[model samples]
Target: MNPTIELLNSHRSIRKYKSQPLPPGALESFIKAGQAASSSNHVQACSVIRVQDPSKRAQLAHLAGDQAYIEQAAEFLVFCADMKRNTEAAASTGIEPTLGMTEQLIVATVDVALFAQNVAIAAESEALGIVYIGGIRNNPSAISELLNLPEQVYPVFGMCIGYPDHQPEVKPRLPLEAVLMQDSYQEHEQAEQVAYYDQQMSEYYQARTGGNKTSNWSQSMAPMFGGKLRPHMRDFLIAQGFTMK
Candidate 1:
C-alpha cells in the first residue's frame, strides 16, 4: 500500500493522551487542511468551535456521557453542521431563503463529516492522536446552549486531539466481502460472514483488554437496538431550526 493508504488502514482511536500540548499552529493547520474537503455546491455549511476554556471543556465532558478525554485532550473541538451562514448569505440577495429542508440537513451533516475526516487524517499524518466523540448528542440542547450555537446550526460531534500516552492495537473491521456489494445489493452469505466477524471481534476484545471484555460485535450493538436511543434528538433538531421538512 502507498503511504496514505497505510496511514488510513492503521488508524486507531487514542483515548489516553499525554500532558503535552500540540505545537503552535498545529490545530489551525489541520483545520485548514479540512477545509479542502469537497462541500455540497460549495455551500461549506460547517463550523468548528475550539474549546480551550477549562470550565467549558469540563461541562462538555459532562454533557458527552462524562467522557473525561474531552477535558484531558490537548485540544477539543465541536464540529457543527451549520446552515445559518449560508442561509443568511443567500437571504442577503433580497430573497427569502429556505430554513429547514430535510435534504439541507443531510447536506450539512455530510459536509461536516467529510470535513472532520480530512482533519482527522491530517492530524494523524502529523503524528497527533485523535478520537471522535458522538456523545455530544446525548444532550444536544445543553451542548448547543453551552457553546452558544445559533439556529440553523447544531453540533454533530466533537473531537479530541493530542499526543498519545498509550499505543492501542488497531481494532478489526468486517471483511470486505461482507460490506462491499457488487453492482447490485445481495446478502447471500452475509449472516455467516457476520457470525465469523463476530467471533473475530470477540477474540479481539478479549486480547485487547486482557480478557476483561468478552462481548462480540452483536452483543456490543445491543444497547443501540434495545431502545429508542436519544429520543430527544428529533425535537431538539426541530427546535434548532432543522425541522427536517
Candidate 2:
C-alpha cells in the first residue's frame, strides 16, 4: 500500500494531547486540505469554527457531555453543516430560495463529514493527533446558540487536534465481507461475521484495559440501540432549519 493509505490505516483517536501547540500556519494548512475535499455541486456547504477563547472552550466542554479534551486540546474546532450561505447566495441571484428539504440536510451533513475527514487525514499526516467530539449533539441547540449559528446551519460535530500525549491501540472495524456487498444488498453472513468481530473486540478491550473492560462489539452497542440514542436530534435539526421536508 502507498504511504497515504498506510497513514490512514494507522489512525487512532488521541484523547490526551501534549501542551505544545501546532506549528505556525499548520492549522490553516489543515483547513485548506479539508477545503480540497469534494463538495456537493461545489456548494461548499461546510463551515468550521475554530474555538480559541478559553471561556468558550470551557462552555463547549460542559455542553459536549463534559468532554475535558475540548478544553485541553491545543485546538478545538466545531464543524457545521451550513446551507445559509448558499441559500443567501442563491437568493442574491434574483430568485427566492427554498430551503428545509430532507435531501438538503443530508447533502450539507455529508459535505461537513467529508470535509472534516479530510482535515483529520491531513492532521494525522503532520504527526498531530485528533479525536472527534460527537457529544456536541448532546445539546445541539445550546451549541448552536453558543456558536451563533443561524438558520440553515447546524453543528454536526467537533474535533480536538494537538500533539499526542500518549499512544492508544487502533480499534478494529467490521469485517470486509460484512460491510462490502456484491451488487445487491446481502446479509447472509452478517451475524457470523459480527460474532467473530465481537470476539476479536472483546479480546482487544480486555488486553487494552487489563481485564477491566469486558465487552464485545455487540455488547458495547447495547446502549445505542437500547433507547440510549439521542432522540432530541430530530426536533433540534428541524428547529435549526433542517426541516427534512
* Tens digit of per-residue lDDT, candidate 2, span 112-166: 9999999999999999999999999999999899999998999999999999999
Write the residue-wise lDDT of candidate 1 on 1-245 in tens digits: 79999999989999999999999999999999989999999999899999999999999999999999999999999999999999999999999997899999999999999999999999999998999999999999999999999999999999999999999999999988888898977678798888999999999999998999989998988999999999999999999999998
The per-residue C-alpha lDDT of model 1 at residue 201 equals 97
How far off is residue 76 in model 2, in Å? 0.3
- In model 2, the worst 10-residue window by lDDT is 221-230
Superposed by TM-score, candidate 2 places the C-alpha of residue 90 at a distance from the truth, in angstroms, of 0.3
| lDDT, candidate 1, at 79 | 99
RMSD of 2: 0.8
